[model samples]
Target: MNEGYRKDIIRYLSVLNNLGGCHIDTINGFLQKPSYIGASPPVSLFPSSDGKSIGDALYQLSIVLERMTDNEFDDTTFYHSKQLKSPLGPEEVRRLNEISLSAKVTQDYMNTIGRVFQSYQLFELLSSLEEQHITLISKALTSIFPMDQSITNDISTSKQKNYQGIIEKIKQLFSRTKIELFLHLREEIEESQKNPHKSSISQATILDTLDIKSSEYYLASALRQLLSTDENSLTTLVNELRKIQPLQITQLSLLPFKDFYQILDLQANFIQMANTYQFFKEDSNSQFNISTASEIKMPSTPEIKIVDQPPDKAIYKRNVKPAPSVSFQGDSKDLDGNYYVSVALLRCNDFSEEPTFLNGASKPTKITNGKIVTFKKLKVMVTSHQQGETLFCFRFDLRRYSSDPETNPNDFEIVSSVHSSPISILSHSTQLKSTAIADLPKVTEVFPLSGPSTGGTRICLLGSNFADTPAIRLKFGNVEIQPEFFSGGTLVCNAPEHPPGTVQIKVSNCQNQWSVTSATFTFEDTNTINPSSNISSDALSNILPESVFGLDFSKTFDTNFIIKGLETASSTLPSSNGAHRNYSKQY
Candidate 1:
């Protein structure tokens, strides 16, 4: 009896597997074949709200089957069902032979069958809960089309008698939108009963229209969707389990053969439907074989832009501070429907040396040609908006790259080539605090106060509190340019081209403060220098000593002597001596 019980459960599960289009393989049946068969149904038989109800049933069945095999379970270690030891009857043998390609599909289906059967408690609860529900739906149906017996049994037996027209009409009614279907059902129930007085059922309010009567019938239609044996029913029996307690699970030893017999009614119903409906009939030519490779199409490349970058100086405390994040926006026109996008970090200046997760971790930072931080790889889905824009924050484990700050000091900027800015990663909060309270730059003098209008004349500015950072900017009059480099107490930068007139020279450290020297720069057209002037090309060339030109002037130089030389040279000038002397004193 136990063997027969097990075999009978297998038979039903097999039928469901075939009907539901579940493809199962050995050991990992559901995992291997995750998709369902056939096109989607216009309406599902099972309520989608009762999510995973059927799958839960299948899983429960797998557990029961696993327990049933007991000592003979070779597949227990694999965590799935194995073939039963029960003697195969002719029907079981025939069904087994029909799908003899592998014994695993039977195992997978058996698991699902066990789950469904195990949920008998929940099913019983549903039945008890829907007692009035069934009556209301029946009443609604009988009012539309008078019947002598229960509408549920009639609908079931109608297929056996080839009464598809009634079923088709019922399907048409259910195919309407939920509101229309519920409202129509409510109307039919109200008209048939004609209760003039207000009862819960007779309430004509709009809110009452969506009450138990309509909702239950809608649920009934969803339940019916699970049994969709046609190709049009894309409804999957998996993932329809609803949570309910008192799931009174029966032991295999206590399980009666009558239970199997009761479930056989479903198989009979399916066979009857197969005989009546063209869709229920299996097509030998139809195959579930998916073509992995078809006509080759070139993949599309999306244009990704980083809309937001990490803060300039992110504090690097192990696990105490939030890791900086970058936001990227991709153009959908080039995405070509591909939703999987990847974003990673790379050293802004050096692509070869990627910021690895932990300083000593074995994982390589490089992926493909681009070196990306192995800390995390961001994969995001493209949205359906008109812009096709989606926001994703790049996050990764905040592991120390090195224990010593000297080895991995935060000088380099980390960025994503897709689009990003250089960000300074400070190892200590004190460094960030120091940066916030950095001293204001004070420029006392700018030597060689005059340069040719063509620009490119390297000038040295004497200043205190100057920092050698990328933020340093030098402005000759209104024209501004970044200095090549800065050292303690001095900054060297080429004067930008301006009109052949004097303009104030200002220096900025980008702290929103500018230090303007009293002296101004005079731009002179070198081509217009008078030949009679003693301010010779040699003197102008010798204006800055070789030590200063070579950037070797770490020692302080006399600003007055340099101004004296320029004044003496200007004294020999034809007409610019007065203007040169005036400019010289300001220094």
Candidate 2:
């Protein structure tokens, strides 16, 4: 019996793995190869939500199968299922296989050690809670579809409490959304029950519509999702379990298989629709072979990585490949295909990416060839978390925030820019605290300011407040080059790579306060070799000027210090040479 149980669970996993991309309501045995020898039903790929739900169930089953195998009770694993080689291309097949492997491992962590051993208790607890929930949902469902059965929230479970209100709220929410499919399924169930014995509807069809492979797996997976969302579901169930005496659990554990299943089926509402077939079918199926029906497309959103300061390179830093740039090109749309207000994380401090968590861990400051921060367009609709005065964006910085005239509007004042409309959050003045907004370091003199374009100049900054403050950073044309040393009224740092021209050298303090110098450093080109120095004396003399013309300074600052030909009254000016073209023009 135990071996059969394990086999049944593994085959269910195979079904999930193969048709995991299909919507939960569409999952049925015909979709899996072994259930019907003929052609299978065409299955559409599930949206991300349903895919996650189905994958999670398979993950849980894999865990149970592994545990049962460790005790040497069964040889069944989804790996041992009989299927031919996959028809999917190599990359898609590889990714699908990896998804299955990763999901099982994730479930291992999700099912905490204590909960894994008490699986049956947790399963029963969740199912009992959900049966009450189903009763409530059925009320909301029937109200929307009055032609269906006369289901009511009035049939409350003994342990259930304060659920009718929840039903009303669910009804209001579902009435506005695409939950029509659910109502239609309920209608289908009601019509099929008119002749219960001769009903053509298969058990798999009803189970799929209820969105479960088995009652235990469905409740378990729903509880997992609820732990992140409706956390009260888990809390309520666990509290009720705590009230149960150990003797009751021991009795439940020792009950005969038939008696236990009978009680289990009685507790669930969907079992009524699937009464013609075993709730947990124990049939061996073909091994794993990925099909083209499920195509797992990679998501557009990048999993950003924080790159540490890399080793210095010869190429321009910005031109070098940078860390990921996070984008939300489609964030404005809500789940219901309606537009809502959106917010972005804006940086205010001259330095970027402040650590949010307790530890100094944060995202990397490095980004592609442009600035790291920008504003994202907001969505219009507001949800609960985004009540009145929605947080359309988060403005952050390593230190203090000062509006940059370059990044701000032309007509806007930098000081008053934060208070403007469209971009809120700067309006609060009561909580503003006085902290270190360091003064911009003054540069009275820059010793050896000039350097080669190759950039190895040892430049000393002689300015006020140039002491070794922890956040002092020197930027030579945007690239922040680290300082070698800093002392009272002095800063020593290396020049960075630049073209053969003067660049604005700026000083930024720990507070992101900055002051700019007008082209303090001049970069000279040193790539040319002097051919005159290498030339021999004879060769040099041949190229030397025959005579020199001196510009007399006697009439200094006068534009008309001219030279004329002597006795030129009847003499002709020098004739044009063979190589020169001369022409007379009438003015």
Candidate 3:
């Protein structure tokens, strides 16, 4: 009989001992941690006391053991493991301790009406209570994890129910918890829109209070939906997460945007371990049936058509201005409501890549004549499109979009796509435009042709067909600056500091249009010039090779000094054969 009892004890203890790892630790710590109210025990209902009966004694013993686990008896002179102070009084710890032992053996045994059983039954009772304790902490606390108004209502309306009914109730509570978490996250996201820098509640606090382990997929889907609606929420959440010391976001600050996706992906893998504890099951063989929860319905793919296709050649000035935009029209009747519409810019070469398809649950869906037109798809835009709307305009944000194909074949593949026509998109500076040379602006002359290399020299540039706009710039060699003031035929600008040499001057409208002047401006070094010293013509002809090769010595002197020590050197140095004063070397 003792052996049989030991087997039962071992079996129950095995189940009890299995409660380890992050899930159980998280739940236990969550229960043990101080609530917003105060630092209090998990429950007052199971307080230790001298029992009225044998069953009552068992309950008291359970409470005593639990308090031992909580280290309630530990003090300056004693530890619970080595020497424990009894709850009844401050007494030295022993198996034969006076107060607690007398209460358990004499008072409880005499008061009991039933037959006194073997000591094995007591061990069995203790194990059973422990199992109940685990269950109480893990399951019963689900409805009151965070202890909000909703939980108060649940407790007020609570009643006794059957086993199956109780299971259903727990499941419902889990669903409600998920909903509350979603609502809280939505509120944070909305608040972030008003003040992006506002710190949100910590995710650790949320994870502890919300019981996220049981509702992983639900919470994940909620987060995914939230991201789909407002992408800025992710940025706000990430910033808030960076505040957590354990996440080690100090190192993550240097990580690229793609690394954030990888971090999220790793966190998402925890879904596989979600709801792993099976407290309701009788044994390992017992099947736990979980009814499928309702999910967010993904709307059917609408037939997308380009209503107002962008020009064949669109100019994107990077971040200076808004990116290229195209107006698209989707079937309003077919689409039930507004949904996310993603736009891609695919090159002409992408259409001829190996055929690929968007892998769906049932079958692969092809795009654009089944030629895998979105192989090298650059996802430039994502905008919300509504039904019955005349047109949905998507402005491409190509700041992160890449046109290059993956060097690694194992890279992430796109599963859903829509792309624009084969269009050549060029940057504002690189875009080619045909303009007649005769119609272009011409720089005829520049007043005060020379200025000190110390800069701050006001000069007037005389030109023809000069753009009468503030956008016009006077470019001296590689250095460019906006005019202080400009008109149709003339503009004035302060000379930017340069080396003591002549640089070709030009008037640029910044639209890839330049009015080149045959003349140049000389930045004479006043400090280096000596009117009394008469240098021979042969000595003045010996120019530094750095000036000829355009070697920049700006770092040492640090003033955009492209050429140095050429205060009196002429623009062209005479050759050894004395051919022409126009001696120049084209490097």
List the candidates ranked by lDDT, beginning with the highest: 1, 3, 2
Give per-model CA RMSD.
29.4, 29.0, 31.8
Alpha-carbon lDDT of model 3: 0.35
Please tell me which model should have the higher TM-score, number 1 or number 3: 1
TM-score of each: 0.23, 0.21, 0.20
lDDT of each residue in 133-244, candidate 3, tens digit only: 2222223233222234343323211221222233333344344553445456656656766796887545454445555565432333223232323334434333333232
Runs in model 3 deviating more than 4 A are: 1-434, 468-471, 511-513, 528-587
Q: TM-score for model 3? A: 0.20
The best candidate by TM-score is 1
| lDDT per model vs. reference | 0.36, 0.33, 0.35
Q: Note the clash tally of each candidate.
A: 24, 14, 0
Better of 1 and 2 by TM-score: 1
